[model samples]
Target: MTAAGLPMEIRSEGLPTRVRIHEVGARDGLQNERTVVPTEVKAEFIHRLAAAGLPTVEATSFVHPKWVPQLADAEQLFPLLGDLDPQRLPVLVPNERGLDRALALGARRIAVFGSATESFAKANLNRTVDEALAMFAPVITRAKDAGVEVRGYLSMCFGDPWEGPVPVAQTVRVCRALLDLGCDELSLGDTIGVATPGHVQTLLAALNEAGVPTSRIGVHFHDTYGQALANTFAALQHGITTIDASAGGLGGCPYAKSATGNLATEDLVWMLHGLGIETGVDLDRLTATSVWMAEALGRPSPSRTLRALSHKE
Candidate 1:
């Protein structure tokens, strides 16, 4: 049986033996950081992550400089990462303008972020849920026509800071919208880090009942309230194989003050490795990378695994 008391046959059936970790420390992790990390440093971070065996690394976002000044060097950053697989570096594109910038720079993969709750949509994107999806529709089509893959991110899928408990149907509707708009994948985000394992299973079950393939979905969990690992375990039991993580737990929602950083990559890796799951990431190297970044940030990583292993480092 799974840790949550889920029956082994039920939770383990069709379970994937390997999980894909989508590294977002370069983009999402650093975007909210107070200091504007040097462009060269950011490029090196990406390269180091690839060398450490991360298959997919979110390099940076193409949002306007004014919106996220930390990633203002997206143009310069893209060219520096030419040595890495273009498809592995997915840049966040806010709209056609952002997508245009990435396409001009020859980026092959892009991600568009949206919200499941109306309050967050208006606050984060200054648009209603439908309006945001409408804007992404054309962007998805243009990217697809250009042979680029688009990934959709829906935040506040579990609980919104302002809206309290978000109904599952609301999140499901947004999930279907993104998929219908030609997105190849949808990442459900617990933006405020309020999700429990039960909530995760229920939502995934709802999405499954709605005929959304688990293969097309990914989970993005925040570490606040100390529930990130528990939530991730629930996602795994449901056969979810694509997990989003930030090395050193290096990001926070700019709009959600109650939220903390993402589920730490080291913490997730510890759990997956113990479960005999293959992630192709060297634990020692990954922990050292987090430590190196912690020093750069002038603090320490929020990852418990990293902390527990720091003595050896």
Candidate 2:
């Protein structure tokens, strides 16, 4: 290993030449924090992420403050990022009202959160899976009409806390429903992080068989069981180019008790770069940003790559 902790480059065959990282630290990373970060600090965090070469950064969520009090400054924080490309900054909208709030702020891209299981749907949305899909239909339609791109986040795709292991067909059904409802792309979330690499490949193959192209899908894997990277490699082998990651491995489902922090962007980038895959991300800069954010939160980052690199410094 190098002094900076970077792995030696080795290009692997059958993997995409480049991958698009969907940075969720600004939103997902901070949303679960009990410590309320100031609006200015949140804005700086996004700015740092963008400067670090993260092309797509999820800015904030338009969900009500009562639901996610940490991101309650969405309104105040979004406007401050006016200088960034609007298409690169995606916000989360829970319903028509959330979409309205986001549209008012000139958000050009947005994402809707959903679940593949009944238990998570009821716990997170207080609605059945079908009812939740119904709620997102109008919001997605309106977003399409407004010419805004919409992404669908399907949580508990592999397993659920209350529902144990989810069936592949059950997950595929919701994925198809989200695509049919007009989502531009879908993110399959291993929320409780129980997915194995074989399970990942099986799900991708099943989705492809069900007519969902791998091009229109992304993988969001948490490191709860330490399978995030292994699962991500399985997805890359299946031609999935979009990945959802949190810098410094910060994030978890507030609704899912067993869920943990997402796959660390530093770890993902390190793996990508070492594999000779182009992600257009500067590893050093990204690691520094994570360290900075960790200090802001008054704690050390959980990302193994971040800890290793920062420790060497």
Compare the candidates by lDDT and give the number of the best one.
Answer: 2
- Number of colliding residue pairs in each model: 0, 0
Model 2 C-alpha lDDT versus the unseen true structure: 0.95
**Predicted candidate 1 versus true structure: per-residue lDDT over 1-313, tens digit per residue:** 2452212323244557999999999999999988989999899889888888888999999999988999999999999999888999999999999999999999999999999999999988999999999999899999999999999999999999999999999999999989989999999999999999999999999999998999999999998889999999999989999999999999988888887999999888878876767789877788778888889889988898889778644
lDDT of 2 at 25: 93
Give the TM-score of each candidate. Answer: 0.95, 0.99
Candidate 1, which segments miss by more than 4 Å at Cα?
1-14
Clashes of 1: 0
Which 10 successive residues of model 2 have the least lDDT summed? Answer: 1-10
For model 1, the local distance difference test gives 0.91
Score each candidate by Cα lDDT. 0.91, 0.95
How far in Å is the alpha carbon of 256 misplaced in model 2?
A: 0.8
Check candidate 2 and list the clashing pairs.
none
